[model samples]
Target: MKNQVSTIYKQAERFAEITKTAIITGNISRAKKCLALAEQLLITGSNETKIAISNVYLFSVSSFMELRHCSISNLFPKSLKAEYIKQINTSGV
Candidate 1:
């Protein structure tokens, strides 16, 4: 359990870095990677730590959206936003 928690944090940190780079580069691919990694970690991580994981995921998504707004000429996918919101709500984040 402790190892799982550590792995989750490490994975989240990597995803956060990827997301930040995506924000700077305006690269959807990088953002996708971030989202993928974050989701994978959350799914594999312990239920006991889900609240914290969900909070971090929410923050990353919001950060990505803010950057998207600043750099992109068009909005990001609505479904992606919806998914994150759904996850957060379902997870009680």
Candidate 2:
């Protein structure tokens, strides 16, 4: 169990590194992938630390907000509106 947790931690760290690189290089696609992986790992994490989850949620909300504002109004479907609503609820903003 310890080993598994360690592996997950390492994987999360790798994802964090990738996220950092993506941010530095302005590579949105890689950043999105890294952020998604980071969210998954954090979801399974038993660690008490919550910074990872918070970071993921904030980043994801920011990304989606940009998408909503930048793209055509028709691009975001009504079905996905609930997802964004949930996000806004979780973010408390």
Candidate 3:
């Protein structure tokens, strides 16, 4: 179980990096897809992994917003935003 969780956490981190890169390159569709994959991994991840992925997601989005001078409300897909919110609420982070 520990090894499995570790693998999931690492996969989530890679996806998070991909998401960030997609955002930086103005690839909204790719970013959304990567974010969705990360969220799916989060479902099976442990608490620590969930928190780490959440932080990465938050950081990526915030950095993108700052770089683009855009509003957070306009950044992510509605479903992604909803899933992020749900993750935060459920994870108590």
Candidate 4:
């Protein structure tokens, strides 16, 4: 069981990294989907996994805030604003 939990967390971390990359590249849908998968894995793990999930969400929220307020126009798309909100609202991570 411990090994299985560890593996799940490992997978979650990998997925989180991928999600972060998608966010950086302005792929909101992909990022949101990946993040949802990560959260699912974390949800099935122990309490520590929940804490790790919180950190992941914090990182994502901070990244979104930075991208949304970026001075350059292309860094963040106006159309993504609604999607971002939807993602955050649904993200229990």
Q: Which structure among the candidates has the greatest lDDT?
A: 3
TM-score of each candidate structure, all chains considered together = 0.50, 0.37, 0.53, 0.44
Model 1 lDDT per residue over 1-93, tens place:
654535555665555666777767868786766656555546675774454456665466565666556532233344445556676587686
Candidate 3 TM-score over all chains jointly: 0.53
By TM-score, the candidates rank as 3, 1, 4, 2
Per-model lDDT = 0.57, 0.49, 0.63, 0.54
lDDT of 2 by residue, 1-93 (tens): 654535433544545556566756767677666555545544565664334444443344446446546431222333233344566688798
Please write out the lDDT profile of model 4 over residues 1-93, one tens digit for every residue: 654535544654555567667877988778667656545644575777655555554345446556667432233233234344455578754
Q: In model 2, which range of ten residues has the least summed lDDT?
A: 72-81
Clashing residue pairs for model 4: none
- Misplaced by over 4 Å in model 3 are 1-14, 74-93
Evaluated at residue 47, the lDDT of candidate 3 is 88
Regions of candidate 4 where Cα sits further than 4 Å from its true position: 1-14, 70-93
Residue 41 lDDT, candidate 2, scale 0-100: 43
**Candidate 3 residue-wise lDDT, 22-75, digit = tens:** 877888888767766665645766787666666665555555666778655565
Q: Lowest summed lDDT over 10 consecutive residues: which window, candidate 3?
A: 2-11
- In order, what is each prediction's RMSD in angstroms? 6.2, 7.6, 6.1, 8.5
> How close to the true structure is residue 85 of candidate 3, measured as C-alpha lDDT?
69
7 in model 4: Cα distance from truth in Å?
9.4
Residue-level lDDT for 25 in candidate 2: 77
Candidate 1 vs candidate 2: which has greater lDDT?
1
